[model samples]
Target chain A: MKMLGQKNNRDNREGLKGWLNPLRYGWERVSYWLQRLTGIFLLVYFVGHVFETSSLVGGRNAWDTMLEMTQTTWGHTFLIMVIGASTFHSANGIRLIFTHVGIGLGKPGRPDYPYYPSSLNTRQRSGIWIALILTAVAMLYGANVLLGGD
Target chain B: MRELDNMTVKSDKKAGCDPRDDSFDLKKTTLRVFRTNTAQGKDSHFDSLVVPVQRWTTVLDSLLYAKSYLDSSIGIRYSCRMASCGSCGMKINGIPRLACYTKISELEDPVVVCEPLPNFPVIRDLVTDFTQFFNHHKSINPYIQNLNYDKTEKIDEVSSSHSHRQSREEVDKYLQFSYCIKCGLCYSACPTVATDTKFPGPQALAQLYRYYADSRDAGKNRLNIVDDRHGLWRCHFAGSCSKVCPKGVDPALGIQLLRSYMLGISKDKRNV
Candidate 1:
């Protein structure tokens, strides 16, 4: 709280810049950062898609022009990114649901010296890898669809 | 490598079974310590001091050495050359860690960067204000109380009788979390605390679980304390709290487990 500190006290809160730096936080934070990023990107794409589809109100002429715009090389690449983001977001979301409910992390016990937290264990970290691999596979499939349909 | 022999004797490898920096080779290393004075309206700056180090010379040792010889104005907080006191927490090489616990040789870097712990207002130099951090811990009612007792009631008596005896399983539930020395390293390492000021950091949230899981603390009515938008719900299980914990107290595990109880998905509801 602002009242907690003296007026001269410097607000050293890491803020947005700290949130962007995921390298030191380990894989879970990286996944955390990526999930939020992809979610926002997808939301923007969703809004854009609504406007793109709404062009149909102008009839067949406007619809065909919209289709042509989306068929460009840059459009195809953007579509592939969308597929990748969605796949990663969904897969990681499922993993997070399980972990958030304490499903995958083993039971807490006595902490030995040189403690390694079980929540960040190999099993949980592997979930991130699985989501990434799934994202890659979906992106490749999307690339194939865009190329083949052309 | 300068005046001492820095050679590695190779042996059969299980995991890099070799002796590198095995001897306590005397070397001079620089510690780029963060310096600032909010009182005088000074901005954050680095004061790099070259200190003589051996294989086992800790960052704290180098810091104190620098303080005594290089710059008496350098502000540092330390107690117990060992890590038990939790007084010397700072960002060492971009990670919030206990300077006393971090050895120069183990870091394998000649220049050690020491800065104030992130997400906390730096009081002077590497020293940070822990008033809010401690307040967050206190907000969770970090002690056992009767189920009938409410927050308004005075919990002055910190009692532990045979009636409060816990089973082995009950002890195991929160024993690991009990190892927390309140170093504030985990709080500094938390990503949620970086931006969300109202959200109780991993340290406080972990203590919430520690008390909740304990069979003795039946203050289950207090569970909703962190149910707000800026509460435990804000924690997306970043797990940085566990990774940078100097004492191995897994705040992240406590958080997720607490979430299970809050979500009504945990196998046993008695932990409340």
Candidate 2:
């Protein structure tokens, strides 16, 4: 018994754009969005790295030419971004793995008023902050190696 | 302090002295309500209405005010005028929330925007269809099953004798999830449900976990119900479902816990 005018796929669905915006819901949402964007960024970088490595068959001159292109300020900045993305991705990914296993999150209790979700407790939120801090440190180190004092 | 409706009132104190002095500052505000008429061949658009307000005025109150004197045809569903019925759910100020639960002053914006909850079809102005949403909930087998039902001597005895009993500890396992009002706020807030139509949104998945974790439930095949491609596995833990849940049901946690059950991480099956 399907009702007419009740069909889905209407213009109402937010479609792909919904993935882009994290809103003010929680840090977990920002983690989700960042994880996705970083995954894509890593994937693109992975393919480019493979191509750069395969250029080794072209001998010393060709390899040096590739290195010369990548050894620029813009290239180093992009590498730093990759470092930050990967660091955040892996750190948050571990937290997600722990969460997915039903660990760390507190037990399901009675949902009293002004209810704070048991899953998003202090421990889990601290995990997010830890991941962010770890990413900042990794990105700084990467900047030092690529574009900074080094 | 003199009362001036649900708005801010000056208590003869200077403005800067009180950091909470947003009172009485906003007397009238504009409401950008979304409107869509399929019958009239009109596209979706926001209908702006400047309505007066008080401090305790909710988004629903503003809409009602506009409906009474401004326009008689604005389609908005509400019952109980409280957060109980879960009918007045809409995106207020770009966030999915219960209209009755959200106060206009809390928005902190001159123009409050009201749109139908996303991830569902718009039936009319600020009214989204819940057909598919309900169907997903139904597909997960939201109720408990009694293995004693088949061997029962009489159907009448099922209610009294066949009824399942539990201790306080057992009750707490699934009690938190039962508070869901099915407001569709979590469904709209979910990014997975935004694009994936097959994924059974958080409400349904959480309800599934509720039944699956119940000590009285004899349905051994509960985990396998959503063990398919479009099942609970699609949930990547975005957690907006729990964040936007008005009742604090934490559907995302329920989904994750259900996954643990499915993966055999918890060997203590209550029915076993």
Candidate 3:
């Protein structure tokens, strides 16, 4: 029994358009891309955060200067992006957890032509919507605080 | 009958006109078909042809029309001309779909971009080699295995007695999974399969869980087959497989159910 050796000849390459076009495949694919994108963003931000805080090793003056720069509009905007990414990542992560644990899915059903979405599909879609809504709410709150709106 | 008579009258008006005349007023849509000759190692190219778009015209119908009238050499594989046989799975426009099931008019775009299903070796224009797919499917031992039941007994004796039975609830557990037609669409739509060919795709893994969930099946140890590096752990739950499935067999959900089962959570308890 050859476990795994075959190589597909045709280029299955999903070009730039394939990655960019979220509406082509529907919400589930969009959610997958968004989850990956948010994960990368979070990872990069985490590394930057560690480095920024590590300025304490540069002594009191450097730490004070670094802290001062964070009070500016640019810093606030960057922080807002971080908050947005965090909100999306956290909410989507919960959705992923539920999916992996088989929470929303019911038993499989016969596929009708033209393809109707199952109850599980609908629930998972709603989960993406809920995550988007949470991200929006977080961005709004973050903006308000950072921009001195209230 | 009235609509048919009206259509006849409309065609009768253009009886003397050239068959290929654009003045016939037939609704036309462009079919952008992917063409290739792998035997000659010719570079793949898109051959776009304008096909008559009737109300009931499917993607398969358009391809067939193009093949018969426009280009005889264009290659495509189809049988049953319906969704049941699972022969005409392809990427229509961009999403994986059954060519026979997708109506040309239903597409949002006027130009229908037809390509062979991704994540498989293309033999020609629209025909893909399903050898790898079958190999992966066979690896999981898709058939039911009752280890406790002895098969060496006389067939007549087994027939005389009532065989092992299952309750309605027990049957329901694996019934949904039994609907798989092995179209390879779910595997084609999978991102994991595209990136990692070694991963036993959504189609096979779903079948694995299907048999495993059956009350009559004695293959409790079958979970070990999928628990390894290239098996169940590789699926990141992209959900593309489930999304593009023409049949409503949710392979992604099945894999998740299998995951929960492996984690020592009972199937009934995992749903909550």
The best candidate in terms of lDDT: 1
Please give, for residues B79-140, the per-residue lDDT of candidate 1 as tens digits. 99788989999999999999999999999997999999988888899888888888788888
Query: How close is chain A of candidate 3 to the true chain A, as a TM-score?
Result: 0.85
Could you estimate the TM-score for every candidate? 0.88, 0.90, 0.88
Q: Give native contacts recovered, as a fraction, per prediction.
A: 0.71, 0.63, 0.42
Q: How large is the i-RMS for each model, in angstroms?
A: 3.0, 3.4, 3.2
Per-model TM-score (chain A alone)? 0.90, 0.90, 0.85
TM-score of chain B of each: 0.85, 0.87, 0.88
A-chain TM-score, model 2: 0.90
User: After superposition, which runs of candidate 1 have C-alpha atoms over 4 Å from their true positions?
Assistant: A1-10, A148-150, B1-24, B147-162
Residues B81-154, model 3: lDDT tens digits: 87888999889988888999899878967899999988878889999888889888988888889766668878
What's the CA error at residue B198 for candidate 3, in Å?
Answer: 1.5
Q: Per-candidate DockQ versus the true complex?
A: 0.54, 0.45, 0.45
lDDT: the better of candidates 1 and 2 = 1
Residue-level lDDT for B73 in candidate 2: 91
TM-score, candidate 3, is 0.88
The lDDT values for all models are 0.85, 0.84, 0.80
| Steric collisions counted per model | 0, 7, 1
lDDT score for candidate 3 against the true structure: 0.80
- Least accurate 10 contiguous residues by lDDT in model 2 chain B: B9-18
